[model samples]
Target: MARAHWHFPRTALAEHYLNVFDVGISSHLAFIAPRRKGKTAFILQDLAPAAQQQGYLCVYASLWGDPNAPHESIVQALEQAIDACASESKIKRMLSSKVRKAAISNEMLGRVEVEFANNPKSAGTRDLTRIDDLVTQLEKAAKDRTILLLIDEIQHLATSDDFSGLAHSLRTLLDRRQGRVKSIYTGSSRHYMHLLMSTQSSPFYHFANLHRFPDLGEDFCAFLQNKMASEYGVAVAMGSLVKAFGDLDHSPYWMQRLVERLVTEKCPLREAMNYTLELLDAAEGFEETAKTMKPVDRLVFLELADNGNPFSRALLSRIEAQTSNKGIPGTVQRALARLMEASLVSQIKKGEYHIEKPGLRRYLEKQVGSAPSR
Candidate 1:
């Protein structure tokens, strides 16, 4: 089997945007990226580095809430982060001494504090009295400065109204303490974040610097390739790289999975290609793209996904040939408009429509035939 092309590996953010995240550049930065583009990785890699270096307390909370009670997710995450930062002996000592001093029973705190010796877990399991005390402790712990609150997939947090109220509460504390607390919000859902910020009526409007993670580029691909060669000894050739990129639908997470598969299976390039395509077919959104779309819409996307990445209207017309016997140009345009509105396709480079989602692209290509662009 032939050696397949492989792309350079680097964090998605390291691909485009460059900044140290210093003063005046709003401590609040909101990250938006396509799903599986390493949004969480960026949180761990890029943001965590700066926060740790600055000696800032970093609290990571998943915005995806529980169905039962979701209101205090961030608050809970912060508590956990604080607890985890404590040393094991320190936590044990604190629990024993604090409980003894307060005359509190072991049952009140529930689980042993030993489990929460990790940074985030420490505050996570605290009782109500402990929660009130934790806030005061954090205020003192910060040396009157702010703790960095990092929330991941923030769009999951209730709504802007509820989040705004939380932000307002945080703001009140920060204002009173004078720069003792800061926050960074991140989300993978671009449309949801846009909706939250588009209206000034929302509480979090203008709250953070909106930074978009761009597509993986040559540098990132190169880094990834070298890392594979050095660390995993997987010699991914240029051909495999191109093939992987073509099949990847351009998501970092899937790309990483591809790398892991290659290294683990020791599969030949041809086998890897087949495996990658299979993975794409089995991915989450592919079924819906193939099942839900109108035939014309599916054909339009298939052609775009295959040929132009961005295809011409003339090309779209050709793809929709089955329905064109009706001679309805306005109807055809509206169909494309609907696909775009549904985010099934996006304008790649003016006039040229491409399937916006990687899963959709693979599904469309696999189902309907795609006409090569002229």
Candidate 2:
């Protein structure tokens, strides 16, 4: 039997962005969402396909695709997009190289692999220069239609000093070709995303219109219900599905896993929800992360988890009482810095922070003592 393709139609959202581009409001767009929220899948499956149908040359580059050097990934994706546009034969060759035969499955393609070219020992100025040239080539190749560049994990460029020059070059490219080249950038880290866009010293500051990528909403829940009933004869309650979705932080990736347990293992809804929560906890390594925190940092995390204001006098008093140390602003600042460094929390603004992981609050509540309501 052929493998089933499960997709949620986010093409309407994509079209809305394109319309934003059409209205001359903002040629560039940026999406900020937490990890495993299906941002990449939305780009690859829905947005890219929609753009293609509308005669836009869509190219996707993931900065983290090459951990050692991210510029290589950008260069490779642009080159592939150029190749696909150059000739029909070249596109066929590229597709053949990317798609492979499955061993024992009816699936025609195993997995599409995107291979990046080798980078030099130090990929600094040279790679950045090449990226600039590649963008120009892609623009030239896209004669009539616009070239849509979808960059994933774009926060990587802003986080590391090594890619600062590339960031500036990218900003220059987008600025120079505002009408011809439109780009959509997606990042999992709001903290880094803010650094990229909010800081005056950053290259991409105010480069694009920022939009919060929404979670899989009721439509996805309805899709899950219909898919379950039609495909596996499993009629799960809508509320149970919605609860599982909420428990998993509205991540479609984990929701699929919960549905899989219901279908394959015949697990009840409550048991599957508990199992999914276990999987989520294991994946986040919350317990291990808490073990690494210093006593004061852990206390600060608990305080923030309970929605206590970090800069409030009440919080300082609680911190001093719990840690038996003078709860000066300097002490709280240091603890907050450490928590942000551990990726457990993120500073949204001055003296304002949020837990990066949604499930982290529940995890901390179970491990540590609970606090007063927000």
Top candidate on TM-score is 2
Q: Summarize candidate 1's per-residue lDDT along 101-170 as a digit string, tens digits.
A: 2223211322212212122211123333443456567656555335766666665432333345444454
For residues 1-374, write the lDDT of model 2, one tens digit per residue: 12126667787888988889889999889999987787877786678767877888787777766745777888998899897987646644543343221112211211111212233223577777888888888778878778988898788776667677778888887788756888999988888899998889999898889999988898899998898889889899888788778888899878877887888877789988889888878777777776777667766887787788776798788778877567788888898888898777888788789878778777766776644222
Q: Which runs in model 1 stand beyond 4 Å of their true positions? A: 1-21, 65-69, 85-137, 158-179, 227-233, 299-321, 324-356, 370-374
For each candidate in turn, the TM-score is 0.67, 0.86
User: What TM-score does candidate 2 reach?
Assistant: 0.86
Cα lDDT of candidate 1 equals 0.54
Strongest candidate by lDDT: 2
Global lDDT of each model? Answer: 0.54, 0.76
Total residue pair clashes for candidate 1: 28
